[model samples]
Target chain A: MDTWFYIADLAGVAVFAIAGTLLAFRKQMDGFGVIVLASVTAVGGGTTRDLILDVPVFWLHDATYFAVIAAAAGVTILWLRLKAYIPLNRLLLADALGIAFFTVLGTEKALNTGVSPVVAIILGTMTAVFGGMLRDVLARDIPMVLKSELYATTCIAGAIIYVALSSWSQTVAMLAAMTVTLVMRFGAIRYGWSLTVFKEHK
Target chain B: MDTWFYIADLAGVAVFAIAGTLLAFRKQMDGFGVIVLASVTAVGGGTTRDLILDVPVFWLHDATYFAVIAAAAGVTILWLRLKAYIPLNRLLLADALGIAFFTVLGTEKALNTGVSPVVAIILGTMTAVFGGMLRDVLARDIPMVLKSELYATTCIAGAIIYVALSSWSQTVAMLAAMTVTLVMRFGAIRYGWSLTVFKEHK
Candidate 1:
């Protein structure tokens, strides 16, 4: 089970890297900026979570994540050379999958640290959303999670589910949370569901 | 002496919070957004450093930082209501002072953690600049450090000075580094010093 979880985590990292690379390319960023964006998108959230939990950063402790992100970036570059096109919908789907996996993983890690469930849920959402947030910020765009359809809300819901169910069965909790996240995220994208924007009286 | 350092640290937090509040207000952010921006700009960099160093976050361990930030924000709001204008030069001066103080403090903390000099300098720069970078992102503007004159460069210079001189005399090192940062930063602002922006062939 640990092996499977680790593999899925790496897969999630790769998807995030690809998504970030595509966004950077769209922004006309040079090579250095492209790699930085890809790396931050893949690992930024996990780094934030580990930092807050006062743990050794996962990438600094294990080189495999960096290696995987590099591989993903390479593949993305080659694919772009051939096609010169990446559909926005496909990128969103990839991002959704990564967010679902990361949300559950982050919540489980927070729970293991003995934090309150509310804190765990918050950290989980942070883990899933932070990298993308950084990516958007660096790209000089309003973060999609803040502007788009139900992005962070889906992560929060998935994290809440994992925190609520983990005591009963870890496997069940993980699976249920990931499934629900994917469904809600996909539904939001398909239906264009979004929370109301906050506007103040001038 | 420790009490002096503590007081300076709180002053730095207050300056950062005031700077963030001013920026958010320029964006017409609501009261809640203003507070959020102020808090993040005051504590975000230190939080990032603590997380990276695997140490307890200072603000979480001691409430004084939060209290100072809140007081600063409150004062800025009241002052704004009365004056209806804040000069840009005053804001830049406050930010420069905060950056100089934070760079030395962060470098000292990293050295105490027994890290290498390079890591200490990097962490110091991060501690000084990360909050402003975040404030810019939240406001949907390019970060000043990335685009403006000598912002992060001054922090790096200060951190380097602190790391190089601290083994001889801590007080001398702190004073020397802070003075150098202030001189360089003010010079850059007065003379319009800037690094060349990276551009790639299309």
Candidate 2:
């Protein structure tokens, strides 16, 4: 269980790092800017969570986590330069999957640490969303969560399912959570669905 | 004492908000982007500190703090068209003073709350500089603290001095810490003195 969660964390960081650095490259930013953006996007959310949990920074102790982010950045930057506008659709899908994984992992971690269920859900949402928040803020773009898109809603759904199913084995709980998030997110994107039904007021 | 600290916290936040929003505007950021920068700049450092210390977020509870930051941004955006530069230098001086103030306040708060003096000093340094860190990161610039400019060093010096002088009256400790930071920062800016002295290897 621990190993699976660790793998999920690294995967999330790598995907986030790639996304941030890719954006920087698109903006024609220098190498240093690319690295900074990558670094923040990889660590910003968990760092926020760790700090709030008052846990010693997991990344500070685990050097490989940092290495993966740096490696992801380097690879993504090179890849971006090599390929022209490679359908950003792939990157968006990867980012969505990564967020879903981290969202479940975050709630599980928070609950394991004995935080209240409400706070656990909030933390899960933060874990899923804040790296992108840092990425968007740094890139000077509106955070994807704030857009009409239902990004945070996905995390919330995943968190609720995870909490409800946590009494089951860890693997089953994770599978249930991830399943909910992935289906909802992809379905929403494919169908252009939304919870809000407000018509155009203007 | 409590009243003065609250006022100082407000002042620190306002200064940070002004600086952050101005930078965002300089880049032609939209209204939401401006608010993002302002909020991050005002609360970013303390949020980082709390996360590291594992405390419940003070800002999440205290809406007034966020309100003040919004007000600052609103004023800056409105008045921006009128002034070529809105006393930015003077406002920066105020910001410097606020940094000094927050450093001492953070240290004292941590210390009184039973954190070790060393940890208190770390928190102090965080409070003093984390806002600027968020600002630079959002602006897509490497944090100035990690640069040749001796920003973090000055913060460290001020925190150390404040902790050492804690036995004295509050007025004296505050004055001494503020002077140390102001003098170091001002001298660095005026003389272009930097801490990045590289030794020449023979």
Q: Which parts of model 2 have CA positions greater than 4 angstroms off?
A: A1-85, A89-129, A133-202, B84-94, B199-202
Candidate with the greatest lDDT versus the true structure: 1
What C-alpha lDDT values do all the predictions have? 0.85, 0.76
Give the top-scoring candidate (DockQ): 1
Give one digit per residue, the lDDT tens place, for model 1 in B13-123: 999999988886666654344655787788889888988897887764465676788799888887776676778887788889989999998888888899999999999
TM-score of the candidate numbered 2? 0.59
TM-score of each: 0.62, 0.59
A90 in model 1: Cα distance from truth in Å? 2.0
When summed lDDT is taken over every stretch of 10 residues in candidate 2 chain A, the lowest stretch is A193-202
lDDT for position A156 in model 1: 84
TM-score of chain B of each: 0.95, 0.89
Docking class of 1: incorrect
Q: Per-residue lDDT for A1-202 in model 2, tens only? A: 7887899888888988887787787677885999898888778878777666666777888899879988998888777778856566675777688788888878887787777676677678778878888788778875665442467778888988888888777788788888888887787677765653122221
